[model samples]
Target: MSKDVQERGLEIRKSVLGAEYVEAAFRSADDFNLPMQELVTEYCWGAVWGRETLSLKTRSMLNLAMIATLNRPHELRLHVRGALRNGVSKDEIREIFMQVAVYAGVPAGVDAFRLAREVFDADKDA
Candidate 1:
């Protein structure tokens, strides 16, 4: 990818995930994992998220459902926070999980709710 794409990705990633979180991710990257980080920043955040066809709020909601369906609690938790930052309401998130329960499985919905709650509680404590 071009330097411009990478820079845009980094900016968007930081805006969505928080500058501290993105900086820490880069800070902890080793030789083995650095490439993975670069790919995620450049491709996932820049190439995909940079597109203006869909709003960031829409993307965050879609990510929440897909990540929940895939049973990725870590990514789900991160995206839950991002979702809120992107203006996705808690009620909307609950509805998304409820939909996940119907199609994806009750277990997936349960885990998504639990992870979301953890993120919510952590923010409260912070």
Candidate 2:
């Protein structure tokens, strides 16, 4: 990609994750994980997240719901958080998780909720 595109991706990654988080990820990258970090910074946040077609708020919510429904509790927790940081309200998150319970299956949603609450608790202290 062009330098402009690469710069755009870095900007998007910083915007979505906060400079601290992105910096930590970048600084901590070892030889084994360096490529993955670059790919995530350039692709996930750079390309996919940089797209203007969907608002970050909408994308975060959709990602949380989908990951939760898919039984990926770890990702669900992280994205639930990203959704919050993207301006999704706590009540809105509750609604999405509740909906996930109905359409995605109760057990999966419950586990996701369990993980989400853990993230929320940590956020409260931070």
Candidate 3:
């Protein structure tokens, strides 16, 4: 992987996910998961999110919809925080989950909403 791409990815990842979170993620990575961390930072964040085509807000919104559809609770929670950081409003998130309910099934929507609320509440307390 290009060092530039990896650097770009780390920058974007820290911006969207917060520096502390990204640092913690790296700090916790063992040999087993270090490569995955590097790949996500370089490719997922740098190669994809670093693109200029879409605004970060738009990307976060899309992620919310897709992750919700996939029913990936952990990622959904993480991205909910990222969405807020990327300027996605709680109202917009609600609408996305509602759309997911229609197309991805009510159960998925329910879980998405629940997870999003948990993030919101946690942020409030923090």
lDDT order, best first, reads: 1, 3, 2
User: Over 4 Å off in model 1, which ranges?
Assistant: none
TM-score versus the correct structure, for each prediction: 0.98, 0.86, 0.97
TM-score, cand. 3 vs. native: 0.97
What ranking of all candidate models by TM-score puts the best one first?
1, 3, 2
Q: State which candidate, 1 or 2, has the greater TM-score.
A: 1
Clashing pairs in 3: none
Quote the positional error of residue 46 for candidate 1 in Å: 0.2
Model 2: clashing residue pairs? none
Instruction: Show the lowest summed lDDT stretch of 10 residues, model 2.
Output: 73-82
RMSD of 2: 1.7
The ten-residue window of minimal lDDT in model 3 covers 12-21
Our tally of clashes for model 3 stands at 0
Model 1's TM-score against the true structure: 0.98
- Tens digits of lDDT, candidate 1, 1-126: 799889999999999999999999999999999999999999999999998999999999999999999999888989999999999999999999999999999999999999999999999999
Best by TM-score: 1
Better of 1 and 2 by lDDT: 1
Check candidate 1 and list the clashing pairs: none
On residues 1-126, what C-alpha lDDT tens digit does candidate 2 reach at each position?
A: 566666788887677666887788889999999999887767877788888999999988888888888888666766777788899988888888899999989997788778888989999999
Question: Once superposed on the true structure, which residue ranges of model 2 sit more than 4 Å away at CA?
Answer: none
